[model samples]
Target: MATGANGQVGHELLRALTDISRDPDPHPYPSPGGRGVQCISPLPPGEGGAKRRVRGRPCEIIPAARNGTLENGTACERIDLADLDGLPRALDRIAPDLIVNAAAYTAVDRAEDETALALRINGDAVDVLGAWAKQHDARVVHYSTDYVFDGSATQPYREHDATHPVSAYGRSKLAGEIALRDSGARHLIFRTAWVYAARGHNFLRTMLRLGAERDELRVVDDQTGAPTPARLIAEVTALAIAQWTDDAAPLRDGVYHLVAAGQTSWCGFARAIFEHAQRAGLIERAPAVQAIRTSDYPTKAVRPAYSVLDTTKLRDAFGVALPDWQVGLDGVIAELANTRFMNREK
Candidate 1:
């Protein structure tokens, strides 16, 4: 089950899994089938469903209540990762075969002031979950970030490359990876960069809103990385999981870099957003997007200058080739536009 099901990756994962589970033989593009696939609750008989039997005591630290049932009848319990004392009992009860840790302390700039909180949640709690998973014999899929590297490399980073995180958030996430490695449990760690979704508060949404509201926008141009879609990550995660179940070996229980196929700077991504919005008539006029350096726009924490990760391992190992960043960006924009249009109708 997914831990951060309400977050960007979690939300899309829920949708994609629901779609696949419903139609195992669905076309790559399912429109020709005339039957649209979507996530549905109270799954059809013989389909897997989550119940109280799957989740134990819940602990939510993200302010929102931690209880809900997915369309597939999977009863999701959002628990605060920091509450280590209560986790063992919860794990004992849930008895999950696979635990996908999509939850993370992702406030990059704020993490400078909240380093302890970041470590507690991102580092310490991962150890706790890893230990629990080992005892329960459950496999884990953990999410990581490109910031784990210092971003000094002119070339893309391989999975086995040395990591020297420059920020508190990055260090903490790196620590989590170390903990998972030491735990001796089967684990898959995916390190991604510049992640965004159509539904969430991401760079794409922010740019779309600001491009329409302002006459000019200044974005950092020096930093370069793939702008990955959360939906694509979710889909790839599922594919990896399927591979794991198929062979359990050769999947290599270690880190893999997952991102969109191509790389782009923040300025380039912003320009693409505005251009797509203008083409789709979501905005009448695209604003001028000015390029700036990281030094020009200072923040609480230092960011990586170039965080592009090499996806050759994932491609060679899993045969999972990610779509281009522009293609993923277009899909996100279409989803956003469709969502907005549907909301307006209601």
Candidate 2:
């Protein structure tokens, strides 16, 4: 079952898993004939009639969200993570062997005042998921954030580094991580940074909106991390899921850093977005983006000065190569151009 099915990552997960599940081979990627790029672009329905199975059974994906319907108009199982008392019962009714959790309370600055609500959804609810997974002998795939760190490191953070969250949102996510780790359930915790997609309310979209409305914009330049695409994250997750039943792949349960290959500050990311948007005709000209210090744009929550994550462990374990941040950004821009650029705000 996939939680947060209506969300950015969750929506992509549904597509990726659906694409892979239609393949006859259990190991869908790293194709023997060496044409694996097809896996990145989703195939039209009935294009590949072959059925992919997990452990000798047909693969079925049950997507759950707070709403009963997805943005794409597909029905899903309704599940609200904040409803703590009903979580276990919902899981029991679904009885999925594998759970992919993409849901969380992601409001960073708002979490400062709503600390308890953030903890309930991100921390306590995750504890419930972990405990249920353990008792039911189910495997879990959970998404985590880079905010668990205090941004004190000059270098990229490794999986084993000590975490000192500097904000309430960060603390809540860290609590989830610890709870999942101690729960003794088979799980893969992916720590990613600066996630965005073409369709969601994220930095890329925000930048485009601001650029269209005003000629000048100021963005923070000190904080640095890779801007990861939600599509790439979902595809990599699909690869990991494919390895779950493959003896040769040898899936290991642990925490891993998953993000694009390069680092950039928020200012740099905004500049790149405008550049791409202009080229894609989403904007007629690139706006003037002024670089500013984090102090210039203070929020209720404290953001880490730097939160780049090292992906050496994920590469060594999964045998997957992540594209550069710019490359991913280009793809998303191209997608937006083809689908929604003409309709977008001028």
Cα RMSDs of all predictions? Answer: 7.5, 5.7
TM-score of 2: 0.90
- The segments of candidate 1 whose C-alpha lies over 4 angstroms from its true place after superposition are 23-75
Q: Which candidate wins on lDDT?
A: 2
The stretch of ten residues in a row with the least summed lDDT in candidate 1 is 52-61
In candidate 1 the C-alpha lDDT for residue 85 amounts to 80
* Model 1 TM-score (2 dp): 0.86
lDDT of 1 by residue, 1-346 (tens): 6677777887776655555445443432233213222111122333432221112223221111135554355656746677778767776766677778887889999999999999988999889888988888878889999999999999999999999999999999999999998998889999999999887678888887787689999999999999998988887776566456445453468899999888899999999998987777677899999999999999998899998999877765565456678877777777777787898999
- Per-candidate Cα lDDT values, in order, are 0.76, 0.84
